[model samples]
Target chain A: MNIFNYELKINLKSSLYYLLGMIALTSLYLTFFPSFSKDTSAFINLLEGFPPEFQNAFGIDLKNILSIMGFYAFILFYILLISSIQGMNLGVSILSKEERDKTADFLMTKPVTRSKILISKLGASITIVLITNLLFYLVSYMSINLIIEDTFSFKVFTLLHLSVFLVEMIFLSIGFFIGVFLKKVKSTISISLAVVFSFFAIGAFAVNASDDKMRYLTPFKYFDTNYILKNGTYELSYLVVGIVLIILCLVGSYFIYVNKDIDSV
Target chain B: MASNIIEMKNLTKYYGKARGIIDITFNIKEGEIFGFIGPNGAGKSTTIRTLLNLIHPTSGESTIFGLDTTKYPAKIAEEVGYIPSEIFYYDNMKVKELLKYSASFYKKDSKKRMAELVDIMELDVNRKIRDLSLGNKKKVSIIQGLMHEPRLVILDEPTSGLDPLMQQRFFDLIMEENKKGTTVLFSSHILNEVQKISTRVGIVKEGKLIKLEDMNTLREKTYKRVLIESSTPIDDNYFNIKGTKDFKTVDDKLSFLYSGDINLLTNKLSTLKVHDLLIEDPDLEDIFMHYYVREE
Candidate 1:
């Protein structure tokens, strides 16, 4: 348990700079918007003049263009991008990093089982993902409160943020699974990026193309911001699917990492 | 009592269809320094990997400290310290952090052990492992392997990157560990180092244990280079003596490898009034070459 905490501490310390950088970027984009005032006719006319395909690509509905909820939808893309990057970086590097660094032999030489070592690393990685998402949520919430109108429901806001976290966890676990299959660090990073961005692309295309049934194919589509905003609730089916995928990926990662042949120091 | 600290009974490993190691059998007594000496691609690393359960053997059985390697690898790992040929550490981690993380597995007093090892290996605990030289990284690896005070220590090419001074220090460290009843099994291509430390040595060749014996016995049984100066030119037929190979002939002098009964050759030479005779004991490298050439 102490070892798990130590591992977590090390991960958190290493991730702090990246977390701060993401938050800084998020805050800069949210606070320094080119058009901030809601009553400007110029902004309203510009929104009206945008193509429907462009609006759909950005998850902007026709009715909610001038509303604070719509702005939240625009910022959500950046949030998902940042969260996925963090998740993948943390997840893919956790166990395989030992192998990449040639430190597996040094670690294995100790009086511990492979299962225990793996569990500790997994625990640390999950904690990093959770902490990063939570930090992003908190920063975004504060920014939204200060910059956007008060009409935004805290409950719906929480649901949207929680959905983003779930999607991140799913992607993170997938990255963890990739780490077991890929040994080289560069390959692990490339594969992780490819996987996360590919899912994002699929979900974006499915939503923009108005293919409701196929939206379930991509995890990002599972968190429907407009549905959550309108109904004041998350989709149960999507939540369940996300949870199941996360569990499967995590279990698969553990099985593969434990049995894989590791070169020692 | 545990019969052997380490044992392998006809162990074999295959990487796909290629044999990694084949029919290797040996045992190391408790607290003895056992040397695994071999040339490149001779299966030394494969055999060590099998013993540590890093890779599963295709056939045969291995045990460390009386526990089956495959069946109870975690248990065996708990008692054995392993230093692999190549050492790599997480780039983001400092040396201290790396060592701490490594020591966490053993469920021991890691802090004290880490401090002691840092002092012994003269390592900079604060530097990130990526920034350290290969020798320093090897020192860090040595510290990690020894910190837990395991019952058995297994090192592959343990002194490859170290300077002569550090290598001597490492030898001293191994000696100290052996004195405290820790069994040491090390593989090296450097025959002199093996000869200095190993109570018994196993010579591996082409994935086979070509020779296994006490160091003294191996030294005694190895061939001697015989140089002869004949009163008259010796017959070329004399070169056909058993165990004589790589025979070279000059005007009145002859040179050949001699591994068999020396008395018969000397007696045969005495009839021609031997002018001068010189015999030199073969070193481990010579013995190794002899076996390889003979096999070919």
Candidate 2:
């Protein structure tokens, strides 16, 4: 319990920064929605001029371009990118920072078990991600209400928010797996950015190709916001796959961390 | 029948193909300060870490307080305090916060001991760890290791960055702990530090325990340097006797190392007109060299 509390306290400040950064970014984009909706037809006409491949790559849907949900989904593509970066950065840095800072000897020599150490760190990361997503949902919801006077389906907005959380979970587990397997991560942010961006790039290519199998490769395509907006639920196949992947990564991380030797610096 | 506090039987560790420690076996009795001495990369830290369960042994096993080390590291660690050669802590935390965090591991309340140690070590608890100098950081490590008042304390080259005055104070602290029946296993390459307090010592070289003996026995059994000034020129074979080695004659003087009876040497000197004579105990470096050369 002490390890858990210590880890949580150490992670709290950075997590607050991530939460504020996400809120500020989402609010900045939300304020532009009211002005953009007035010129919806003009914006749709401009989007139509672009090639189909470019439109698919950027997740632009021409048929639903006039609705608020469509605009939210379009902006959400970038939101997912930023959220995944935060999750990956947190996961990788949480475990690897001890070794990078050469404090493993101090921590490992304690009376706590290795499994406890890994679990405490994992719990801290999960808590931070959950808190960030909750604040993001509340802030985005309030901003959306402030913008328009008409009614919007609360269910559709909720499904879209759940998709963001799902994608972030996949990225966070991947980052954690990398940290456990790599032993020492010198530049955590750079490695995390590279990995998150590569997945985003691959998701873009999958969009252009429109291949069903390619969707399995990138976490971004797991919960399609367009599908969520229309069907009002996540795809079962992708959701199952995402859950299995997270479980595997987390279990593997604990196993490797417990058995690994901590060499003196 | 007193039990051994620590027992390692044929313990060996290999980092892939490279040797870490091999076929090492020794036991430290309770309430004794056993010194582990070796040069750089000679596997002093490797043996200590293996006992601490920081690194898994490739073969064999070690026991602390009669419990398997690898299987029950946390249980063993509850009563053990380890101070490494290089000290590191969370840079974002203040000294008091770090110490408090370290104390939270054990089930005991170390508030009083922590305060006492802080005063004795002359540590400023309010300063952040990143703002501390190396020696000051070492002082923090000492306080953290001893604040819990553990039954066993293991230190690897613990006096590297400390000044002479601090080193003396640290030795006094360890002596105080040992007097309270705490077992100490101290590792270092410097012979003087170990010689000052150790009851028994194990010398390692090339990943093997080459010698283990009581400090007094080791000092008494090793060779002694003998120098003699004769009034007249002496024959080269005049002092030729058993246990006399490295014999050299310069002018009317003769000097050599002797490991045999001192009375026998004095008997030989009485036969000659000895102007002056000096027999001195050899330093630890000479003893270490003799062991290495003899092993080769």
Candidate 3:
């Protein structure tokens, strides 16, 4: 309990910052929707000028761009990118900071198992992500109503938010695994940016028409906002794959961290 | 006759073929201040870390307080306080908070002891750890380690950052703790620091325990640095005796470390046409240098 509390306390301030950033970014984007809807046709006509492949790669769906949920999903693509970077940064830095700061000797010498330490840190990261997401959901949901008069389906709007949470979890677990497997992480932000951006880039640029299997390679494509907004539910196949990846990364991280030797600084 | 508090039987660790500690076996008895002496990278930290289960042993086994070290590290850690050579804490935290966090790990209430240690070390608990100087950080490490009041304390080169006055106080504190039945494992390359408090000493070289001796017996062996300036060149066998080694004649001056009887050495020195003679008790440095050189 002390370990969990200590971990949570230390990580609390940054989490609040992420929450504020999410609320501010989404609220600011939502305010522009009223004027943008007045010029919807002009915007759609300009988007249609680009080839279909370019639209598909960039997740620009013309059919739903005018609707509030559709526009929300469109904005979600950018939000997801930022959320993942936050998740990955939190994951890697939380566990690796002990070794990076050369405080492993102090913590590892305490009367607690390594599993306890890992779990406490994991709990802290999950709590931070959950709190950020919950507050984000409330503020953004209100903004959609406050900024635009269009009646958005509460269910589809919800499915979109749930998808973001799942994708963030997958990234967080992968970050934790990398943090444990690598002996040292020199710069958490650079590594997070490099990894998150590569996956984001892959999702943006690499859409092979013949083989749709490429979607499995990048977490960004796991939840198609178009599919969620239309079908009112997550695609079962990709959802299962995301959950499996999370479990595997977390389990592997646990086993590796438990047995790893903490050498002197 | 004290029972062994820590027993290592042929413990070994290899970091993927780079030697860490090799077949090192020794025992530290209860209520003993056992000094682990070695130069840097000579496996002192490796041996201590293995015992603490910071690194798993590649082979062999060790028991602390009659429990297997690897199998029961958390349990062993409950009654152990370790002051690492380098002190690192959460830089953002104030000294008081970090100390509280460290104390919360053990089942025992340590608030009283924590305050006592802070007072003795003259540490200001209000200061943030990042703002502290290197020596002040050392003080924090000491206070945190001892506040829990563990049965055993393991320190690896613990006094490097401390000034002489603080070092004396630290030793006094350890001695005070020792009087109350705490066993201490003090590892340092500095011989004088170890000589100040250790009841027994273990000399480690490369990856093995070279020698383990009682402090008094080790000192009583009386290794003297005997240097004689002879008027004429001395024969190699002229001072041949049971405990004379590194016998070298450099430019008509015979020098060797003699551990034999003082009277025998004096009689031999009187027979020689010595221009000057000097026999002094060898410092711990010379004694260790002799051991290290002899091993090579």
User: Which structure among the candidates has the greatest TM-score?
Assistant: 3
- lDDT by residue (A1-265, candidate 1, tens digit) is 7557866876797677767877787677666443655455776677769887677666766555456665666677667776787687678877777677666666665556677877888788888877877887788788777765556677877887788788778877877887777665655667667878888788768877755877789887888888887898878888888899999988998788667766433
Q: What's the best-to-worst order under TM-score?
A: 3, 2, 1
Residue-by-residue lDDT tens digits, candidate 1, B105-170: 665676786787789888889999889998998998898888888889999999988999999999
Candidate 3 chain B weakest ten by summed lDDT: B287-296
Span of 10 residues, lowest total lDDT, candidate 3 chain A: A204-213
Candidate achieving the largest lDDT: 3
Write one digit per residue (lDDT tens) for candidate 3, span B1-296. 99988999999999998998888899999999999997788899999899888899999999999999998899999999999898999999999999999998999999999999999999999999999999999999998889988999999999989999999999999999999999999999887688889999998878988899888977666578889998866889988987888787788888899888878887877777889988876665777778556655
TM-score of chain A of each: 0.88, 0.95, 0.96
Report iRMS (Å) of candidate 3: 0.7
> Which pairs clash inside model 1?
A101-B88, A101-B89, A102-B88, A105-A264, A265-B84
True contacts kept of 2: 0.76
lDDT of 3 by residue, A74-105 (tens): 88888898889889988988999899998888
Worst 10 residues of 1 chain A by lDDT: A31-40
* Stronger candidate by lDDT (2 vs 3): 3
Interface root-mean-square deviation, each candidate:
2.5, 0.7, 0.7
**Model 3 stretches astray by more than 4 angstroms:** A206-208, B224-285, B288-296
